[model samples]
Target: MSDSNSILFFVLGCIATLALIALIFKHRFFRQQKYLPKRVITPFERKMFLRLKEAFPQYHVLAQVAFSALITSEDYKIRQRFNRKVTDFVLLNASLDVIAIIELDDPSHIGKEQEDAQRDAMLHEAGYRVYRFTQIPTLAQLRKTISG
Candidate 1:
């Protein structure tokens, strides 16, 4: 082969190799990034699910029990005279209308107990229960927690 042709072939080979590497990385990275099924769930929701998956693996079975079992009225918007507007998560058998509000807490909850408390009271007065899980509960735990 002529020197020019050989060099061109080498360049093409390098480009192809780089493309393959990029494809591989993209595949490997996002393959594990699959979130839950609901497309409407926000980034916070997905983060919550991921956290739950990580922290409470034992609850995997429970998490799948039923959406109703864990969250009775997810994203339930409430406009109360208390000047507190909020969404609700009702635990299935908790007997309370809203036993928990699964807030995906990060550094915010560390020193913001007051803020959390205010939110809790808003739901409380509205006749609901509240259980704050700093981290996400695993599917198994979520299943059992809601089911049982």
Candidate 2:
């Protein structure tokens, strides 16, 4: 072949190779992957959830609530501190207003009292009632704690 034709074929070959590589990378990187379903709440959390529901049938009890969903701040850094943290439960009144923030402290929270206190302070600063329970309380106790 002539010099011009040889150069043209070489350019076309380079373009084709690049296109093939891109397609392979796109398929490998962007393809959908399978995700398995798992229980949203643990067995221990489920027990507390049931108790809360029974204690306050008229109110809404939400489990595994995100801090971001509950509160926000104009300062991004201050907000970031609690943005990714998750609360054990949030109780909302009949009007859909958040009444209280509930945290069920298990053995895992033994050494994290300071961290938990800071989190509680942040929520308290936002005008939320924070309740930390080491064990599930009785119906009367729940009513007393939430009401007063």
Best of the candidates, lDDT: 2
- Model 2 residue 50 CA deviation (Å) reads 0.3
Candidate 2 per-residue lDDT, tens place, 17-111, comes to 99999999999998877787889888888888998999999899999999999889999999989988999999999999998889999999999
Model 1 earns a TM-score of 0.38
How big is the positional error of residue 51 in model 1, measured in Å on the Cα after superposition?
Answer: 8.7
lDDT of 2: 0.92
Q: lDDT per prediction?
A: 0.54, 0.92
Candidate 2 residue pairs in clash (backbone atoms < 3 Å): none
How do the residues 1-148 of candidate 1 rate in per-residue lDDT, one tens digit apiece? 9999999999999999999999999898867755667554456656666655454444431221222333234345533233333332333323434333455565656988887787667656656555666666776765566445
lDDT accuracy of residue 100 in candidate 2: 87
- Where's the lowest-lDDT run of ten residues in candidate 2? 31-40
Provide TM-scores for the models.
Answer: 0.38, 0.76
